[model samples]
Target: MATTTNSTVVANTSAPTQYPFLGLPYDIFHELCLYLAPKELLVLYRTNKTLYNLLKSADGKTGVDGKHLWKRVWQNSPDSAFPPCPPWMTEPQFVALCYDDYCQRCLRPNLLGAGQIWTARVRYCPECIKTQFTPRNPLEDFPKGPYLNEFINEPHLCVPITPLRVALGDRELVRDHFHTPDVARLCRAIIDASAGAGGATDLNEKRSSVMQQWRSQMTQCHEHAKLCHIWQKQRARRIRKQRLLAKRYRRENILSRVNALGYKQDVSCLGHRYQALQGPILAVFDKIDALTDDVIAPQVIAFFDERRTLREWYWHRLIIGVRLGYLTKALDEYRQAAPDELLPHPVDIATDPMLRPLFTLPMSANVPYPIFQGLLPEWIQTWRKRRDDLLLSMLTDDAPSLWSCMDSKSHKSHSSRSVTRSSASHPEGPAAIFQHFYCTSCENLISSAAATTHTCCYTFVENWRAEAWHAPKTDGKFPTTTSDILDSACAREFQGITGWSSSCLRPCAAVISDILITLGLNTKFNWSDVGKIEGMHLRCASCCADKTLLVMGWRRAVVHAFQEHQGVHLCWVSVPPAVSYKAQLVEHARHKLTKEETAKRTSWKCHHCRLPRAMDAYTKSRMDIHMRFTHCIFHPQQGRDYYAAPEGVQFLHPTILIAATELRSENLDAVFPEGEMFRNEKRVGFLSRVYVTNMS
Candidate 1:
């Protein structure tokens, strides 16, 4: 019937077939279909009619029964998520149940697993169940008489009440619920309509037997619902544990690689972060034809070591290049004025005033700079190409397989040969056919191969993991403060000083080690080891039960208490600060500079001017004023001087005022200090005429 429906659907469309894979020969087409998992096959089946007709045709072009093909395909699928198919269900129905979580009636994933109500064979969530079912009270349904009421409430009828099954003419199921009178009348009509089918001579016996069967069926269904509920919980828990174990294993493997290479634990190398680098590195590995770990480990270590200074140069070059290449008006002018063959050299970037500070040649003319400069143009062109490739691969999901490390011969030909010999005895491969499902809540494209969780349930677990850093929402609004969170019942019950739920109280090391794993922070560290989570309040393990102290020194008292009296052990509870510690450190440094020592007494004479001895070797504030007036320059300020020097002398500090003065001198082709003295030179000539008689 499905095949016929598919054929009719294709025949109705005037447009040509758009299905890509149906062009293959029947043997090849069937072989390709065998590679898809049950879930993927279901997607393939629903995609279009041509493929559907091909898959569903009786004893297909290859002379294989379609039903048997489906069974074999399901049997070969590597995902063991499905249970044994019930005796009443076919392979197609079982595949449908395994693949998706959307409720049959509501068309939403409200109930994770489709808990099919047994007698009706319809799956629904709790809310949908309530909406679809009409309660049937025996007393209310039948006529109002003592005999009828007694019969309705009889000991034989004492089973748990089930919802009325609404079957219309021709056995068509009706999903909508109706009021008592309409429902009771319809149910009575159906029961009475079926009385003749039993063919009993007496009316009571037939009615009694029918009621008995109805009660028995309802009781079995109610028991089955209970069992299904329990089974779903157990399955969900088992799958969750397996997922956590797999995640932990993957995390450990990445960490071990990082440790082996003695690499720093930066945001790029930590949990889930390595995904960004995975494709690029794998491509490189394939190009070199080397093992992934062996090539990648050394390459990363060498790259970081060589690029330490080179990276800084690249950043500088990038800034200079972009500013000169695009942002500057000079580039546009050059483009307009210059001939086609005579392009501007990159060395001309020094001419732009806005770029001069960064483009100074002599200051940064190291070995790395020249190398970085040579590579800059090409690198800039392709900087975003790899990232774009990864994005496209993720979207298309036809990414090149990373499983090429296995025996190459086996991967391509083993399955084909096995299928040709006997499709039934074909073995599954190490790699499973997986499809990516996007989770909107967590923004993770989860692969079905990596986990067995429903995308909906997995999202909640991800949200729970994030609760360590992120304050959870209550009634759609997130609490803005720690105090607001503490007002909740869970927080109030916590014995720790932070007063947060126990779920948030993970070991600081574990949380800080993952760094971006939980909160997905963009922070990067330069350290070579897993750094401690600093700027947090620590609770002493020994003293916390009796008293809480904010300082680590209180451990002495805990030790004394333990030795002298009883009960104590060394454990610590590290609490994250509400305010940023980095901000606090900056503020503290600023305060110390401003309050204690902003003006320092100095012997560094202003090189821009020749001042009187008493006025020279002045305080930092006076020198700044002297420079501002004499040279039109602002002097660089510093803290208090350690030692005093003679008046009108200098200590060699690289003063910005002096460098500017020197640069001005070089540009003007004249000497400074003398330039200031040249101003005094004219005054002294006039003073000699007034104060002394020149005999000559």
Candidate 2:
């Protein structure tokens, strides 16, 4: 454990031990008991009947509101990993374990993440109850504790805290921890009860101040809660809208094929012709279609002769049946199998005179869209927007283009560097433009009259531009300057990039918008994992076929294809981690080249010259030179054609390209190292073309 103290037990003994609890709330006691490292909780329970009996109750509560005290203790208990428990622990041991709990997120733990110094106890679960330190644990990126093997030899146990017999006041503990008495803003309260100074004093005064501060913080939370609630509700509504669209597509697809059969030339198209017919007419068609030559239904054909009136009757009958819940089960099944929106719209049958009877079906008053009796205008708009964004993400490189545009000199990059003043004693006007621009993240001020784009600190560019610090020129047209978007909200037309939220552009922001837009269908995923598979830029999620999908690769074919087809968001299984696309391509190419090299080394025969030659030197150039100059065959014709005099040539696998790219990279590595080396297989093809010509 990373700590300054040296008094608490550092490791559990070889004998698997149990916990020893003195006092605890019933509800918390039960939870904490279970949270103990492992066997330690059982040991604690067996210590005495008073604590053991109290823990037996299932539905229990700590009578007083402890203000997250028990929760803290439970979290601090040894991590879920590590399989061993601790024995009875002192107050310092308890406090130490509590310090490591509650941290769930953050790529790596920094100085602030390990809160062990302020605590006195080291928390451990019953299982593997040595100091609850993780060594090389997956997902733990912090310098936690030295592994068991590296910590100390022979299963030793040392108290984790300083040598002390008493507790310390707040300030003294803080001083002991952070090496500063002013750990927090407050002073003159309790202190560390170590041998030097500090004891629990003026508790009442500190409590009052803390209470006031807590009240103020609670009030602030109350004020912001309303906005948070509104935003959350809006998000829910948006998600619901997307779901309805997906459902609509599913429903629509169900009856589409059934309806398409109306155009079927075969007289036996039952589903399409009878789809809109009401119950009686539907039954008549069903009976006519069902009966054999043995027993013909006379009424069926007679009614079909009076086409106009008969079709109207059929339509009305079918509509009435559907409206009266007769078809409810069928429609439900349709939803289950496919869905309405996926099928063609029911409106396709509305204009058909044969289907006119279906329009007569009465509407129910209770349904949400009872007024329209179907989808409304607003629903249509919502569906269209999602669908469009999906299509944009799939087909168009709009997402990637945004970043590309921002990167290009024509858009934003070169303009930032246009601040060329050229003189220090008396700089030009352009140099002054660089004065206000500084990176907010790193606090680095940019210098360069020609500098247009901010380097190393260009996040949230629009927000910076909208601020006052970016003062605009006096011209009415307005020169480059920052103006707070909030201040000039009414005057400026704004759109948030919101990369974290956008499905289409966010996933393929660079590749789709940059490479695909420039190259069309050629743009897609290109990855390799020969080495350092962990170092690749990946899309957090994607939008596909009326749903948003969370995946790993930026180029998700199904997602992009479906998003182009339908607009929506959905969840999906992520791509398997550690599979490197780039590495796969490189390895495959190398394997192919190695095979060709092996084959050439084994097989050497100049069949055209009717003589044996070294395959190693049988390159295109060497072979071609030897074929035409040294040994030429008799010709029948005299033109550019091979039969006109060219003796012969041999074919070779295009595997040599792999070697050329490998060679180019080693040379370029001096400047770019591994960065400029990121590439796809096409580079190999281009390099092979050059190598072929040069060697020939």
TM-score of each: 0.28, 0.15
What lDDT would each prediction earn against the true structure? 0.37, 0.30
Residue 388, candidate 2: Cα error in Å is 2.9
| Candidate 1, position 82, lDDT | 41
- Which lDDT tens digits does candidate 2 get at residues 82-159? 211122343324333333343222223333333322222222232212223322221122122322223223211111
What global local distance difference test value does model 2 have? 0.30
lDDT of 1 at 69: 56
Error of 1 at 425 (Å): 99
After superposition, candidate 1 runs with Cα above 4 Å error: 1-21, 27-37, 50-64, 73-84, 87-90, 111-120, 134-238, 253-696
> How many pairs in model 1 have backbone atoms within 3 A of each other, for residues 3 or more apart or on separate chains, i.e. clashes?
1
Q: Best candidate per TM-score, number?
A: 1
Q: 53-135, model 1: which lDDT tens digit per residue?
A: 65676544434356645765666554344444454466566567645677777787854566555434456676677765664
Pairing residues by index, what is the TM-score of model 1?
0.28
